[model samples]
Target: MIRPGLTVKLSLLLACIGVIASGATGYYAYRANRNMLVNEAELSLLTSTELLGQRFSTSIDDVGADALVLASLPSTAEVAQSDDGLRRNSAREQLANVYSSFMVHHPEYLQIRLITREHHGLELVRFDRDADGLVRVKGDNLQEKGQFAYVFDTLTFSPGRIYTSPIAVNHEYGTHAAEGKPTLRLGTPVSNAQGAVVGVVVIDIDLEGLFKRLQNDLPSDYRVYLANEWGDFLVHPDASKAFGFDRGRRVLMQDSFSVTKPLFAQVQSEVRVNGLARPKQAAGQVLAFVRRPFGDSEGNRFIVIGLAKPLDDVLSGATLLGNRIVRMVLVFSVLALFLAILFARALTKPLHSLAYAATHLFAGHAMETLPLDRTDEIGLLARCFDRLRREIRLQMDALHTKQRELAHLATHDALTELPNRVLFLEKLERAIEEATQRQEGLAVLFVDLDRFKQINDQFGHAIGDKVLVAVARRLKQVLSSADVVARLGGDEFIVLIEGQRSADGASAIAARVVNALNEELSVDGQSMTVGASIGISQFPDDSGTAEELLLNADAAMYAAKADGRSAYLRYHDVLEARRREQAEQAERARAGEGATAGREAEPTA
Candidate 1:
């Protein structure tokens, strides 16, 4: 017969092994199921993104093709030449009939027109959309759009090439009939028989209708967002935030999700972990974004589109599987608990001493003297457990330390100990929200150190780093308690100033910042002088959102640099107009040069 001690040990060992093996199997299954669910979700979202992009491309293609057809019509060109009244009248009637018939079939076509470049983009023939519906605009009702990008930009493009305007708040004087309507302008050059571009056939698209087509067949739970090349929200689930440029503000994806910076930077196709949040009633999400390249461009480049959805919707079946596995594991655990209790009772007398020591040891209190002198199995087990507890405590302390370091690194620059881009954006967003609630104003300053690159080249990187640290310290010294400063990498920095009641307060703060940077300073005994170019964009004056404010400030900073370095420039609407006109003029010059070269190459005709 086996000894009683040997039998008890063998039986308990087998029971423990069985429980562990069952747990490991359950754990492995749970992990496998979860991994499978995550993979399925990624694939599903990616597929949906592909569908969304294709649908949008089709819509754009249809619009582009329509513009091209209208532009190519012989009657469309007749509206440009006023020398023949009878011919122009007949062309107008034909064009009006064609436009009216097409608008009926495509209700999203808000307006269609033939505009002549003769009188600075004067509308020659027109149809405008209003609350009542599509109405033909007669003489005097039509207005000049020479100042608009669509008219001016398309005038330079070769015949048959389509030009698109940036999506914006429809602020046309007559569009008061549909005030605040978001619109997109598509135009194709109208050329005469000689191929000389004389005018443009333009179309205005209702943005909401365009979005409706994109949303078609999408799940009800999904929220859609569309940003321009600059990351301004052209379309967002939040109606108020979309087309924020009309309100003199910006709502950018990069401000909300820093990981999405790549989408704009490199025109990347996809980015995971861009930041995910769901409505209260919705399940948790793991948002993934897919960038769709636009067929046409607003200015210099095409736009990148993004889409996101909840994980639960993507992996509906796996959630149920997870719940069932959890239930089965609980039942097995109950059975194992019963077996453990029976096992403990069989060895109770011998285990009593060790259990007493273990209970006090785990509770983190001192234990009474143990029977160490007995030299029995219980005593050996007690000694082993005490040593294990000491080792665990040491490891726990190390883990805690590492966790603290990681948390610190997440929000701060390791070298300067200043807030990084991610943390700065979060703080700025929060500050904007708070300012909105308090009905106060906020300002964002985009600061670029003047000639810091020369210093970096003169002194080694070690000294360059020291100079940055010194600059951070100086910025902190000049800032008020309500201000936040962050390095946006390289020599660029941003400052967020709050509690300002007007733009003047922000201006005062900016002046102080300029003065601070002007002070003499040295890093590592290497004397260096670095001033800053600051751009000021304020809430309610320049922009309504943090992202918009930052963008405006950046634009203003470039203006300051253009004017002269080491000064601040406040954002102005005229600044944007000047920039657009400059870009369009440059494009026009290039086109003219290419055309001249092509003509020169042509043999005597």
Candidate 2:
């Protein structure tokens, strides 16, 4: 019986479509924005790498220039020829001055060391700014044999051209002593006038500074790393004891090997694959890497710079937009449901009213009209219901009238036009109340036809019926207007007299009723005589209630039967006591019979 509303169905469908469209749009926007951010980050990283590479190349060039100037010195040639103390001291002083000037110009460089072309071993000198900014010569017997592998290798392999390599440098020089650490040394081979290698000039730049700069440039949510070709960490932001000399403990190199192993292998390849200048791949994470060579002429060294940004920040706005769209759809659904319910109620209100009105009309009540002002289908239904209600109301009215007539006939007697015993009792209660309020007595007289059953046995029941009906009419003719007479079934009739002065007054009315019933005759060509026994009981004197008064009156009428069946008796205490004595005597006689039977059952001896 329940039908769905059009508005609700449409709204639900629209909400579903809106949610899907919004989710799709949000997903596309998030992907586009994420891709744009990743491209921008890659460009920024490339620019930073190129800038850093230029800085490194320029430092190498400066070191080469200084090395050329030192190699051309006439004092440097004399020191190479002789092992004299004064010549060695002068060469050490000149080298110290050059190193001192280089340190002042490039503060990032820790120290600059110049090695000579002699087996006299190594000379140690430092810039002594405390001593009038001059070069101070130190021990000449200091051995450089074990610490100069990179320098020896450069000279042996590429004899004439400038060579640069990164090497571990000692930290015993002037400013380096205060720096409290060693560094990766950038060493360039010094060449003579004939373009033949003379010595090696080593420049120690702080690798930590480069690492810190790169770390600062990276986004807060991203991680950056610089690693060597061997996949060992040369510089990490959080450099601790674990990463000091234990190359195996480097987290960045291990992660790159595990996550981007293909990219790492491609960087190691001699030829580029896939048209990319540097091979890169993003697998389980979003990562960008660029590899640049960092040494000059001596050997090519790889510095892999990598950056990683998590995807959570990239997709956060998209997720929020999707959630907002879902919420809006839910809100719209609730609003639409509410409006749909209201509209449905408005549409069905007239039908519900018509149903209620039809129920009333079927129950034989007045029909109710419905408002038909609307121009919709509900309005037409209301008009039809109104016509149906009117037709049903007319049929109900005719049926109600017939029911009333039948009810009246069933409860009334045809001869006396008075209420029967059933109705008389009902009226008796009301009369009793009135009499009690008036401080007077009401009376119930039991009028019985003495030997009426014998009269019916002798004269036939049809004639008996006619005699009783005549008796009913004669009683009505004799009784005062204040008295009520009703045929109680068979030949028994009752008279209710209100406002009785006393029991004597009620007995006087009972005498009149007895006389009236004795005169009944003339039915079906025969004249019949029937005597009456009338017994009277006064309310508030004989019994307190209607039922008790009626019972006492009947008992008195029975007493009249014992007296000879043609007179009336007023109920009194003497009659009640005689009836109780007779009942006690009968009970004792029955007990005596029972005792005699018990005695007779004894066994004989």
Candidate 3:
């Protein structure tokens, strides 16, 4: 290197002053910006976590509706009080159908069960939707679950309230449920007609599915995490780290996110704002979280749901703007060497303003946009960042709206908003599974509106459509919310009655169905009464398969039409046996007639 002269020394001195002044200014500006960004981030994260917690709580409350529905059913009452095996079996089977339908609409459920108070906690019915499909574990496969806290503890609870268990990695055996699933068990006491505690119905919700749904609408950059009251990671971005107990290891959220350790101490639910240190990763990592102390009436926390977004993603532009400001200060200092300090001061003020503006990303204000009128690179960079941040927010909102619509349209019926056939069958299969597990009987009533075609012909399709809608409304009025009433197609509806009940109980429901449809309808100011022909089939007494059960019910409905146009018929094995006997007798008579004719025609007998 050559030796420097006076001019070079002067230039070097100006550059050093510019660098030191700008560096000091940038340091303080960055600190203030980082702190501001962190505060905003904390607020945003805390708000999000609170909203998500409330959402989860709302979902559980909806599930509580399912529990109450199960508790109030007369079939559930039968399962508790009836002495007849067929009646009890039928009621248990019907209860299973109700649970299955509930699970169909709620895919997040892993298992829905009604456990009897007797037999070491005998599962009256359990519908476990496993990989194979909905499976009804029965006999040896259905274990005595009374010893479990969900079963035994719920028995002491009030009939209407739900008792939730600590979320844990599921260790359910047999029936081949998905291993290592994060499950939350909810139980409510089922009472007989006399209000005596009969059994406990428990719903095992798939926590992974539930949380994944909660996080799906969120920005892709956001990190969603969940831990139990004890801080075990129920859900984490890293699939391998989640439910660590299943892998014979402990992965506590407190250990993973150190700042969250104090959260467990707070009695009331709280959203904790934190700037955390991640030793293995970036040292600048910050986290904002909420600790929702969720539990049943028995006491304190059952689990915690948390949401976190990295400060790095939200304040990415801060780093770029800081760099640009430093560069601009140096260039100006070199050019205006005599006025270096004043030049640095002028630019530093704007840079600090940019820093302050960047910190308010969460502030929803148009004025919050930084001054972008400069003719230089710093102004351009700031403008671009502001636009980018706004675009991200808009995109997130659009994504959430679309996702919700798609999710709704996928499972519900378009016409009546009831569950479609696909969902109906899922419910049916679950009911079958539960009935099978409990060795209970259930009934599937196939209701076909008599002269529905005549009504459609007399009235236009629009009137016919209105009639169908009215019919759906009427069916709903008679049936409990726990019952599964689905429209299979035009003029056809399927109702699954779960739990143990006698043939008379099914017949009575079928009669009710026919009576429900007998009402006069005023469609376009025209009065028309549509009668129904209902066919009923009971579990264990009827054939298994969805097709077979429907076939049997359909066959019985045809028989009911033959007996009378507006009537209901209970399926019986004797009907099929009688038809077989009559056919055999006819064949014998034809053979005898053919023999007599042949003998007369023949020259030799």
| Candidate 2 C-alpha lDDT tens digits along 34-85 | 5565556555555655555555556556655665565456555445334333
Clashes of each: 1, 0, 23
lDDT by residue for model 3 over 197-221, one digit each (tens)? Answer: 8788788888778877876777777
The C-alpha stretches of model 1 lying farther than 4 A from their native spots are: 1-4, 83-88, 176-178, 274-283, 297-301, 311-319, 330-605
RMSD versus native structure for model 3: 26.9
| Candidate with the larger TM-score of 2 and 3 | 3
Candidate 1 matches the true fold with a TM-score of: 0.52
Q: How close is candidate 2 to the true structure, as a TM-score?
A: 0.44
lDDT, each prediction: 0.76, 0.62, 0.75
Displacement of the residue 397 alpha carbon in candidate 2, Å = 78
Task: Please name the candidate that would achieve the greatest TM-score relative to the true structure.
Answer: 1
The TM-score values for the models, in the order shown, are: 0.52, 0.44, 0.49
lDDT, model 3: 0.75
Between candidates 1 and 3, the lDDT winner: 1
Backbone clashes in model 2? 0
Give residue 94's lDDT in candidate 1 (0 to 100). 80
